[model samples]
Target: MLIDTHIHSDTRGLEDLELMAMCLDGVITLAHDPFEMKNVKVWEAHVEKLLNGEIERAKKVGLNLFVCVGMHPRAIPPEVDEALNKIRDYINHDKVVGIGEIGLEKATKEEREVFIKQLLLAEESKLPAVVHTPRRNKEEITKIILDEISTLNLKNSNIVIEHCNKETVKWALDAGFYAGLTVQPGKLTPLEAVEIIKENKDFANKILLNSDCSSNPSDVLAVPGTVLKMKIEGIGKEIIDKVSQKNALELFNLKV
Candidate 1:
């Protein structure tokens, strides 16, 4: 069974959903900054879609759908406080898993403030956090992210530094946090992901493989595909199982 820990279902069409349900046991769809940063209402509506609409859509296809709510750093709205206030009400909902897709994009002051606030919220709610590391200046921004997280009282295990590359993955693991490897066109390929797993000792315990499938060019079957690659490369089944499913299930406390 496979659980894609990060995806944007709203950006994907029905065909993608059907394909996902066919291969995945479950998925954790997260909230991201919309193209237009209108207001808190936008964030509220998006959350509602994830919790209710998207959940039902996935259910219809026999896939267990989970959600994580938070404003994406790139799209932090003008009404950040109100947006967070709205998110608070949904934190304890059955479908909600954690606070995420939140982290520094440009490393601006506003982004930092919002990122820290959501981290605190996750800590307070005792939920996991999925943090985004940008494509450009990833290493530098990730350093800042780790530094900021260090100041907080949040548990490292409850944090997932996502979109991690070879370098950032080391930092995340060194910090005692989960490293999220997003398999997509521009992200790590299956072979590269397999190599990364091989290079890191006991990586299965700390790595989470995901598709991060969105409107962007991405393979929704990235996780299972990577699993195949791992097997072909002679990676042990136990290690593959942990990175592909167990770690995510435990981190998010997912029943499935």
Candidate 2:
């Protein structure tokens, strides 16, 4: 009963692979970056394909699936209005559960503008967002997301800020936003995620567990790895269940 809160639903070559083999009961798929092509025309085409395509990849993997669609901060091209329109079009889809994988990155003016727009859309749609904090200068970026919520008076519980490490998690938890600890190479390890849970037991109510796997090579088994680590540390079964299953389901309003 594992739910990978952040993974790409469209696995490139793993079409025959099974989510059960990976020990996953479900997945929350964030949108692929549209501007990976780096041209407005190409980006627009990708958005159409992304929003309108059938979810064959998830069906092949045989997992309970949910989706989040928006412009990733790094991929927020010049045609952000067009991108937002696509997000708006799909936000109410039954399979779509959130409005993200968006937030600070490089922290440029363009990134900030797109991020705030997505946040507002999430607010208006009453959907939780899957926010991505930059790998570099993570704390500062996390603070920027928090500051935006304060400035706009957005609800904290409406977003789950991802990739939070020890130093940045407290800010998110203290502010009432969910803290998503991602397990991946060069990020939080299974041991590290458990340690953070141990360190902040009182502030861990909305803690989320995820693998952060995508088309790019990363540990797809990281979510299960964290559960194993938590067990090894004698963490309570209830705590593990909350982080890996219950919290994500509650945050995204998913059931599977």
Candidate 3:
């Protein structure tokens, strides 16, 4: 069974959900910036949709859905504290798995402040964190993320530095964190992802494959499609199973 460790189902269609259910055992939908959000109220409403509306929507297609709520770095408002308070109220929900899709966008001082606070929340709650690495200046931003993480007493195993490419993947793995390879447009393609796996010795244990499906250009079937690519490339089934399913299951503490 495959588990897509990251996706945003809020804007997906029924056809996509059905296709995913046919191929995947489950999915984790993370809270992200609603680009047009003007205030904390919008953030609150957006999260409510994830916690309530999206969960039921996934169930209709027989897809086991999980959630992670956080203020995306791009979406952090002037009143950051208010946004965080809202997250605190829902962080312990039965279906919530982590504090995620949270990290640097512009690497602003305010963004850093907000990012560090959420990291502490994840540490305090003993939950996994799914960190985002921006597409631009990825190396520099990822380094900053790692440095910030180092100051906290959080477990390495509980953090996933997501959207990692060849260079940043090594950084994440070297730092003892799960490295998420997102197979989405403008991210790593299936072949590139497989190439990274082939290059990194014993990397199956520290990798998580995801589509990061959302309103942006994405492939909802990316996790399964990548598995097919790996098979064609003669990657062993054992390793395929670990990256596509087992690693995510263990990291998220998913019972499915």
Candidate 4:
């Protein structure tokens, strides 16, 4: 019942060793990046290869998947229009769930512009957006997102603030938006995450636990570890299930 909200499979139109390793390691619900490339054709080709790779990975390991095709904040403005058009079709793909991993990064002026622009694109496309909030100044980030939600009339139900920590989890939950916890080993830390989940009993419906498993191996398998911690903290299976499965389905609009 684990649905990973964020994952990147590097399909370089060739045999990807990292992807091979992920398939072997039992990763379900991978979210591939469609906006990772600078060239539109190259990005399209990469997405196609990722789709093929998902099919192969499914047959081999039963890996469920979700993918997004919008530029990350760091890699935008090269061919934004072309990239958006290319990804538009895939948004409705039978396996595709939403239009993200698409939001602001605390990188630079250029990155912020790209991120905000993509956020507008997500609004235009009427798809759920996955946002990467700054870890340190998260309250400010939350305020920015809330303002955007108001300005765009974007439903709180249509957004997920990813990699939220104890500092910012309450704000996201209070906003009636889905809050994603990125349970990395030492980054967000196991003890702090469990405490947050345990303490937020009232806002259970607004919470989702995700690995945010990236190219890094240590980041993978983080959801299971979080679940174990929740169990140890005397949290019920019902709450755990909500964090694990129900919230994801509600946020992604998934039938599963």
Candidate 5:
């Protein structure tokens, strides 16, 4: 009953989806809209094609799939607001999990603006949020999000701080929020993720694990691999199950 909370299947081929279908029971693909369309006029349709293709591939494989549509901080264009609103209209379906992959990066004013708008959408829609934190300004962005939750009168429980490294994990834990670790093989290896989890047992109640696999190849089922490694390291199955499955379902309001 494991569910990967933040996989990126945008570039997955048929073979990849089939393999994923066998490996996991459910998946939530967090994808970014076309960022280049800011200059081009026809970006909306292009973005829809990408999202629709992702959903179709997952369904073909018999995996219960869902998606979150938004522009990443790095991907936001000057006219991103228009594109974002267009995306909002299509997000009210059962398969739409949340407004995601959104947040301020490196203290940029533009990213902050886009993040605030997307955050508002998340609040309005009553959807859990998936957020990205910059490596350098991780604490700053985390603090900003927490502060904004109060200013916007948003609840703390509806946000997930994603791609959290060590320091950022602490911030999430301190804030009593869910945290996602992207378990790419060469990038953020499973060993590193296990180490983080091991160190943060104090807040294991709120930790979440994700593959964060885009189209790229790595150790295929990274979430299961992490669970296996944690078990071999003497971590209990209940703890493993909570991080890999239960915590995400509870946070996202999904049935497991």
Candidate 6:
């Protein structure tokens, strides 16, 4: 029952070779990123393609999928309201699990505005959220998220504040949102992820494991490798299952 909670299926639309290669990893369920685009029409079309196109294709390769859509802060366009309207409709799509990869990178006013609106929308629609914190100013960006989330009064479990590192993970846990750790190049490493699980034993089950895999082939092994590291280190299988399986399923209200 391995599940990749955040995977960028195709950067420039589906590539048969890449997807087929991904199937060999044998991760059962994958939540693909139907991330925001520079053009609103393209964004809408991409999501449509993901829902109607790659999803079915994924099935052929023995993979099950759902989408996560949002207007990312880093790549946000000028006419965001138009894009948001289109995204709002897709948020309810039967195959769409949540709105995510949506949060501050530069933390500009435009990005913050877009991020907060989507958070409110997630609460309104009773959908879970996948929030991304910036690389350079992680603590600051994470604090901003906490401030906004504080006002919503939504349950911590319903939202996942993703791409967390040591400094930011504590904030998310303190605020009651699920902490997301990505095991990929230059991000949190497998050993680092295990340490978080070790230190935060009580909250280990409240964390989500994701690869955040890009086009890079080695990234595909991130999640599985991390699980193996935990197993060898004597981490309890039940706790490992929480981050690897149950937590994400419960947060996104999904199963495979």
Question: Where is the poorest 10-residue window by lDDT in model 4?
Answer: 11-20
Order the candidates by TM-score, highest first. Answer: 1, 3, 2, 5, 6, 4
Clashing pairs in 5: none
lDDT accuracy of residue 22 in candidate 6: 65
- Candidate 4 lDDT over 1-256, as tens digits, reads 6565666655222234244345332233433344556566766676665566664655454345556556655455467677777777776676666666666655566655656666666777777777777555667766666665656655335677877877678777777777887777544777677888888987888787766555554455567677778888899999988887777776676654
Kindly give the stretch of ten consecutive residues in candidate 3 with the minimal lDDT sum.
149-158
User: Each candidate's lDDT (Cα)?
Assistant: 0.89, 0.78, 0.90, 0.65, 0.74, 0.73
Which pairs, if any, clash in model 2?
none
Per-residue alpha-carbon lDDT of candidate 1 for residues 105-177, written as tens digits (9 for 90 to 100): 9899998999999999888888999999998999999999999999886664589999999899999999999
lDDT value, candidate 1, whole model: 0.89
Q: Report the lDDT tens digits of candidate 2 across residue range 1-256.
A: 8888987645444542364335887787776573474665666565445444525555656656677888887776677787788778777677888987888887788888888888889888889988899889998878888888778887646689899999999898888888999888878888899999999877656898987776555677788888998999999988888888888777787867
For model 6, how does the per-residue alpha-carbon lDDT over 14-93 read when each residue is reduced to its tens digit?
45324534633323222233454557676667657666776777766656677787766655666778877877788777
Q: Which ten residues in a row have the lowest lDDT in candidate 2?
A: 12-21
lDDT of 6: 0.73
Give per-model TM-scores. 0.97, 0.91, 0.96, 0.80, 0.87, 0.87
Off by over 4 Å in 5: 33-35, 39-43, 135-151, 185-187, 215-217
TM-score: model 3 vs. ground truth: 0.96
Regions of model 2 farther than 4 Å from truth: 15-22, 34-41, 44-54
- The sequence of per-residue lDDT tens digits that candidate 3 reaches over residues 151-256 is 8766645899999999999999999999999999999999999999888749788899999998989999999999999999999988999999999888888978
Off by over 4 Å in 4: 11-36, 107-117, 135-142
Q: Give the TM-score of candidate 4.
A: 0.80
Better of 1 and 2 by lDDT: 1
Model 3, position 248: C-alpha lDDT score: 89
lDDT order, best first, reads 3, 1, 2, 5, 6, 4
Model 5 score (lDDT):
0.74
